[model samples]
Target chain A: MAIKHQQPDLVPLFIRYVGAVSSKLSRIHGIAGRDLEIKLGNDGVIVQIGINAEYSHKVVPDGERWTSEWGVTYEGMRGISQPVDHPLKEPDVSGYIWPDPHKPERMAEIKQAMARYHSDYAVMVDLSCTFLEAGYAHLRGMEKFMMDLHLSRDFACQVLDGLNTYYTALGVHAIEQGIDIIRIGDDIAGQNGMLVPPKLWRELVKPRMESMIHAFRKANPNIIVKYHSCGDFSAIIPDLIDLGVDFIGTMQPCGQQVDMAAIKAKYGDKLAFLGGLDTQQLLPNGSPEEVREAVKDVLRSYAPGGGYVFMPGHYVNLDVPLENVWALLSAVHDYRRYPLNFD
Target chain B: MEISTQDGERSMAEIMKSGTLEKLAQAVLEGAAEDAKRLTEKALSESLPPNTVLVEGLSAGMTVVGGLFRRNEMFIPEVLLSARAMRFGMEVLRPLLAETGAKPVGKVILGTVAGDLHDIGKDIVHMMLEGAGFQVFNLGINVEAHKFIEAFQEHKAPVIALSALLSTTMPQQKAVIEAFEKAGLRGEVKILIGGAPVTQEYADKIGADGFAPDAASAVLKAKELLGIS
Candidate 1:
């Protein structure tokens, strides 16, 4: 309903299930990952394209850090490998191996997913770590890249150009494959504010994102664009709106004066929001009843007339008690029905 | 690290004035490290107190930077620039301050927890603490609980700061605290934790002394824990 911008029977629920929680659910239900998501009552499914696939490569020869096809290195520690070293850290960032975005077999899994659950669930392709994240975070190392943006705009633009060239074409391909939404981003902000200044973000990241979204639209024309950054990228929400971002999500509730009601009133007509539950505090510490109330409160904020999808801010990690997960979905099932009468 | 062109124009008498110090603070606030270095040298050359140059010029600028950072006026790269300026200013004053036998506000032992290689947040806090006049011993990333305790013993730091960006590695925080508890030093040093997934409520539940949501607040909490006020 919200994704289509029409009134639906109930608010939609989406979950970006990570490995541990998925494994836990899989064990409890004796089902595969996709089957478990269906059984858990998710209305949508994320089809990850580049990350952790066969060509993506998870392990390294050193057994410490794995280098991706793009030459980004990741140190294995947690649920997902965190990017540690960037291959393009030198002054001359050229001549490094860029991952082939046009891999013919890449979309095979996405096609399989579409053949399986496309009719039932809203399929969103996560092409994350897209521009700033792909460029600064994994490819160029965050600190050095951010410093270089101010110190060496030419180098910074070169990195951004490289990312834009790959992701824009890749995003267009995803849209052409009939994916419902294209999720593209990097962690451009911290808990407090923008990672760099918003000015810098607009100067560097915004244009690249605009170009990517443009390419995505040129392919599908009606495809919804969901921009994903973990922290407070709310400052760039307007820029996202201008660039035709339909859904904004996995919102980290910290340090910003996030007026949800005001956001809904202002951009609600243009943009739908997904992911509002505070996974950091409320999910990890709050009781089941608290989780239920949080769900209702979030629904009240985002699920009014329409244009809101239910999800936690980030992955439901181990810090969150299993019961709370049950409560989260249960609350979504109970109060998320249309006419949303929460007495 | 570009020095302001105006630095050469200031006379010795004017360099000793509060106006000169204010400009130095402004330079640090703007993250002008070279300008900060030149001003520190000029202030010293003008026979100003080394402590005054550090406190009034550099530290005062960092105080404003921290405040701006908290208020969301300054972001990461901006903060890094200001920190670089503060560090450059400190580089000028360290030798003189060592001769004067001036002490830091307190000592903080810091690390990213075991199995978590994330260090950007920890690095920011380390820089902020050092800028705020605290002696910090950073133990780097993927550090175990026993390693934290070992560092605490070696440094005799008043505060131990732990960070974990991953939920899988957050248990390492609890383990480190438990190790401190077993060592009978849990009460001796204040334990403060922060990261992406960490919460103040979680900190309270885990018996941590405090929780900082960001680096600026971490510095303030470190001071508050050590009774620096």
Candidate 2:
């Protein structure tokens, strides 16, 4: 099991499922889709197919609309184009919006494709990448997406609400499929505290997201809901806990003001924590002992309560050393325990 | 908590310089606003100069709280409540200090840079700077580069801080800096940058005088950049 049950000798190795990559599959699972690339333009329709389906047209059912042979042209796609409110923007129509799972054959095709990317230790689910962020990226472009949330809040809210609805539905379906943890990853903060004022966030995004979380909890109490927002969100721990989040994901130590010891001390009983390693500076820049020392300090603080799981702060960046990854995993597997102490 | 004064009849200044003032500071840092007001009133009744009450009592208290902020010992809400207590104390002193021309320790211009609309960080910076005795001119969010230059000229601020939470809006920092340069006011003022993607290295690369990862460091950087030591 990914989560530790008894006093085990080592931590269970677990890999978080990142979203589907359109790139080449390493032959672990057979390629299911003929056209592999999924692309969204300024228009509304999204086009996804196996590598061979690039030239072929297939009719698919999208939410309320039947989109046949999803168009590649800018105009053929139609959802909120060019982000609703900001200038200097374009909109992405092609973020992960679940295709109609009601259609058995279509759902089967997607499942087959997802199976190609599945792992034994991890269930594939990065639920944090929402259609709203994509819409903002399309409207304002990726560069100003964060700022536009501040500049054009109403529009941001509109996009976020739509994305939240989509995500909640997808999460429910994924849960029914026996996924253990839903990896909801979003960069609400980069290296500082927060991108949007907490007030603004509470006004627009928080209420809807919180509702979704509440609904998820009511649906399945045991399925862990893991959330990741980078940087210093020390102000919002109470809010996250109140919203029924089961696990806090990607606890970056370098950016933001999250002190692992303090957070563990404060919220360990209510929420499990994952990913406290300093992937930004340490994993990419530091040596083996540095990784071990940092890991030890985190273990001392967080592992004592038995609610902590280990992973890098975010994705193990492509630049991170495989040795560093091994060292980090080794320390967790070897040293982490309920009575963890490092005097 | 009632604060005990030194000996029996020490001067208000002396009492302020001792543990009595630190106690009042602790009250504010803990967000004990009622105790903060009562203790501050006692200091004033004891004939503490309003400025001394601020510098020694409130500012000193806030400085300790701000230290917790910088060390990650305290979070934003904790710092914010303390700042609120400091503001209440300042309100008690502002009118009296006006007679002394005890101009704010310095003047700072703060805003969410052009295209960026987030202001929690900017607001916290404003509160901290005001508590630290610098007058702050907040430009709200999505402030254009020209507005900053205009505020600088108007406020004659010695330091200008730019905030951007988005990588896209980060370029606005450069535009604001260029605005200062265009008005022949670049060297006359210090420029500081902060936000999610902003780094000390990026701040230096962009020609900002300093970069702070959080609001507490912003104050420390403010004092350092202005050579206020």
Candidate 3:
């Protein structure tokens, strides 16, 4: 049987996105390298000190090609570092942590940054704390200082609570500044599925996520809350929807049993879908035509309704051909609500 | 009188020579676990040993499915459903076979490597191993090298399956493998590494014993490594 395609009433919806370098009011900005500093002040408000990017390449060559071998030179110590071992390629993209929430002035500064970006459309504020970063930091012996969600529930909650409080405060501030969307990113999935169990997520992570969503809703009843989790999360879709997350981002298409059409059918009404194109394959290895076709497939499968917003499954890696990136944007721009007549 | 009775039994055996075992096995391969179970129970109540039920019925069914999966003729969900059915029937026979001190047809220990907490692939591999008649010990996610080392020591697991979905975490699998090497237990255990970013080349580069692109192949690799026919 041919699958039925349902179209929405709205035609040619213009969804705003971060990460696209445009003249748009709320595009994603970056502060790369170790120049940035973020810390928790004693008074509990967060402070960010942005430093100048001294150099893009952290390692200087001494006629040795970097190779990550078993029992090889220590990481970040010598030679050209392998792409995997490079600090820039690490999973957590946020360069630094946030200031403590108890400090009023630090919070005010973030609030000011939030207001600056928030407009009538959605504005994204990507935060730095991630489970992977925490794990890596722990591997480097920062477990005592970092938020250990597994063993120390209280400490984890304290840290996440502060983070969520700040996140929500920013969302509220964004709303006050007339923003329509608030997106929070926490990489909870691996290429397979969750790094932690669903029960653990519900117990440890979901509440903090909920507090952010709820606080945002309290501030602006109409503001859309988007959350980003990569990999397969078919098990917790219901829980996330129930938690009032309006949109989900970073959908990896090739991982496990992910079928975008099925996901759209299941949760299209309750939650909007975002990021369906395969970044691992199409963005890095595919030609421009393949990229366009992939984008078209995503649009055909999930964009029939007003609820779908398309982006790469994850951030466009540095190695991704600029032409492929253009293919995606051009596909989005040239897509018209005619003939096929999808909303 | 005994000769006449034996002749009568031979006549009955001739009447049932249409290979019902192969028929039930086909159903299992098709992901029809319910149908497989129904037919299997019918075969079982007729005084067939649980091992025969597995060998001729469920295992044979899975062999076909596994072959198709390797060829890409079948997809993940289809293979997973079939594996689930195969596992359900295996669960019925596990204890009964164990009573005779028949260890699992194979042994496997699987975990998501330390610094990487992803478990979906590991869980799928665990399920696939169970379906393939292997006893699996799952150490869950973010598993440290010492924990895997301890588990390997305690279980004497012949096959160690390590998973990591991130590039950063992929290196941790090497650490666990190295720990095995340090303890002089590396050669004794076959190591299988897999995840999203993992490739056969990567596995070979890291000196892993095997690499499977998906869960279905993981079982096939396990069988080949263990010299299971």
Best by lDDT: 1
Poorest 10 consecutive residues by lDDT, candidate 3 chain A: A35-44
* lDDT for residue A112 in candidate 1, whole number 0-100: 84
Instruction: Between candidates 2 and 3, name the one with more favorable lDDT.
Output: 2
Q: Which ten residues in a row have the lowest lDDT in candidate 1 chain A?
A: A54-63
Candidate 3 per-residue lDDT over residues B182-211, each given as its tens digit: 998888899998888777887888899999
DockQ of 2: 0.05
Docking level of model 3: incorrect
Q: How accurate is candidate 1 locally (lDDT)?
A: 0.81
Q: Which model is ahead, 1 or 2, in terms of TM-score?
A: 1
- Here, model 2's chain A TM-score works out at 0.67
In model 3, the Cα lDDT at residue B96 comes to 68
lDDT (C-alpha, whole model) for all candidates: 0.81, 0.62, 0.60
Candidate with maximal DockQ: 1
Q: How do all the candidates rank in terms of DockQ, highest first?
A: 1, 2, 3
User: What are the models' TM-scores?
Assistant: 0.91, 0.53, 0.49
